[model samples]
Target: MQKQTGFASILLILLIGLALTTLVIGMVTSVRSLQDSSLTTHAQTQAQIKSAIGYQALTGLLKPLTATQIAQINNGVIKDNGSPAATIATYKVVTTTEGCPASTGGKNYFCYDITAKSGGASSVVRAIYTDITTGGGSFNGSIFAGGLQIGHTRNLQGDQTIQVGAAPGGENGVVKGNGSSTFYDDQAQFTLATGITVQEYTPTKFMTAEELRASANYIFYANGKCAKNNLYGASIYNTETEPVTCSSISGITVSGSGASKKWTIDAASSAIPVGVLWFEGEVDINLNSSRDLVNTIIATGDMKVITTNQSGAGKAYAPYHYYLEASTNAATKKTRICGSSSTGIPTQYCDTAGTLKALDTELAKIANILFLSNKNITFDVKSNSPMSLYGNIIGSGGAGGTGASSGKFTGNGTIDIKGNLSFTGEGLTVTNGTVNVKLNRGDSSGNVTPSKKVMTLSGLRYM
Candidate 1:
């Protein structure tokens, strides 16, 4: 009976020892678990704080950060708030090889890989990224909103200017946007304060021909009649004449020679002789020489119809010489100068001489015919402004060629005109063959005196 009681006591002591050992084991496991939880919490908070700060710093850079730049953070290329140190959080930017939302649409984004360490164990928190948005937190110093890279808005205006060289590689050349205030998707449109308009003018018709003629200062007559008579109430200057009957004729000869020809008529020795020659073929009234037709006469014939054998040959006749000589003869009617000799003379037809010689009539007719023909010839005549030539301006050239000789003109043939040239003034005398030009100077009050100014001619050498 005493031995059984001692056995029970030994069993009780063994149970108590087993229970104490289990309690110590449980306490140790609880302490270790709490420490692990604290370590994880601290690591996670540090990583989040570091990532937030890093993202803000990155966004401050404005321009997108390259992958290599973000890689520096992952590779521990970073600094703490006060020192260069490696934190629990590692970050990088990837343009590819990651399915991150920041890398969506084939773009790049910032990525952070966080790990918590305690004793010999580690916990990893991965897959944090950002995208651009209007208002969203950044990650690892990277721009983020709506899980994509963010872009800023720009407003440009005309009154404002910009500095471009502030950016890199843009030191010398700067393009400014001053016209438009805002740009979107690389497009810009602007407005202005004012616009533009246009206007034109039309003129009224001028007076009729007869009206102008009646009111004009000068009269123009052609072919013994005024062309503008129907427009202006101007009468044609016409004279009546009768034909004459010749009783006898003398001092007349028709002659031609090899390389030369002439039908000579001389009335200087005789009182007055009038005769006519009938030509069987077309005739040429040759001037002095074929090469010098403008200044000389080779022969005179009954060739009433004058033909030019050379391209630039000219016929020049002066009625003044003939008119001055015919006035002396009483039998030569002055009014019958160019009209039929049977007509009575107009007093002005004769100069001081009462003689009405037929020579003046013939010569006047020749001058009129030659001068009128030259009016149809075309030549290079230019002026600084508009100018009028009162008389005939004859240029010498062969029948169809442009010069008198093989390749030469009769004389220095160029006509160069410069400055103001007028046609009519008080002293402006224009005869049948006169080269009339007007020169004038304006006074301080803008008044002009045409006769006082002179036109200078240069480079005109008679060849």
Candidate 2:
């Protein structure tokens, strides 16, 4: 009996000790788990704070930068010091959206997707930006000419001044470049030469076929009949000249046939018929021989301009044709006209307008442009001097506005102005002094040119 009682007590004591030990272990584990959760939460909070700080810092950093400064940033020049947490920040421009300009030096807009790290975690956001020049110092664009031979100037097109909200130039039109491209009196402007970077340009990045079709507000027909189109609502033409099965347009005149078609649009025309215009067939532009004029056209066909003789083609394409007062008072250079007497714009503004311009003097300062879209664009431009064109000239991948076909230069050609002028899937030949683009818009491109740029997070989604 004594042994049994002793054994029972010892067993009970052993069981109690085991229970206590198990309970203590359980409590310790629970406490440890809570602490672990708290630590994880704290770490996440720190990461979030760091990410937010980086985001805010980058956003502020890009703002207030000059157009040249922006270019430096894009080219990895790293001019400014980034935020402390973002010392390891790196970014690539994921997307760039280009918009038509009101003038040569207006804002060139673009958007980008960035992936950044602030040491703890990674975050992604979209940024929209725009770069604008005053005028007459740049032919802006990042061009990839297969056989580059330029002598004059070229400027890459600029992009939208996109903000957290809102939508997106011409004469008095300033062309915008995305900071990666430029033009010069390098191409023989054929005096037509611009840009040196050997980058293959994918036209779809600027405009896609579907996007092109969707962008048009009106359509014109072969029967000389026109109709209001897709996004033509709220148009000045809608109220003034509502054309449905209409006979003709007032301000626009068309002449010639095939690659020699001559199309003219004058602001002097009773009204500017369409906002964003598109044409099905190739276009011919009959430039004035005796006068310097300004015209705007956006087409999905071949853009044709009347070419002039070699001497005439060698003449500069002056942006100050209408503002003759400035052109004459400009640098000591002669006017774009084929003349020994006419004076061009002063070197202060026009000379710098050339793409890659370094503010030199003695070179004729005026520049012009020719734009081609993906759908089908033919610029049959015939002019006395180098032709200054506006709009896209050639598009590849059938992604944007127009197409390019084989043609002969019945006349000499010099191109002034700025914008996208990419060619592809064809024989590539270029020369120097033939094309020139100066994109200094501050004073020469447009005297009253206005500049505004905005950027912000388009969306914030966590991964």
Q: Pick by lDDT: which candidate is best?
A: 2
Ten contiguous residues minimizing lDDT sum, candidate 2 = 162-171
lDDT of 2 by residue, 134-252 (tens): 32233344332222222223322122110010001011101112212343212223122222332323322233322333233344444455555422123323221246643355656
Q: Write the per-residue lDDT of candidate 1 for residues 361-394, one digit (tens) a residue.
A: 2112122111111011222112221121111211
What's the TM-score of each model vs. the native?
0.22, 0.38
lDDT of each: 0.25, 0.37
Error of 1 at 2 (Å): 2.9
Q: In model 2, which runs have C-alpha deviations exceeding 4 angstroms? A: 1-11, 18-22, 37-42, 45-249, 253-281, 287-293, 306-321, 324-407, 411-425, 428-463
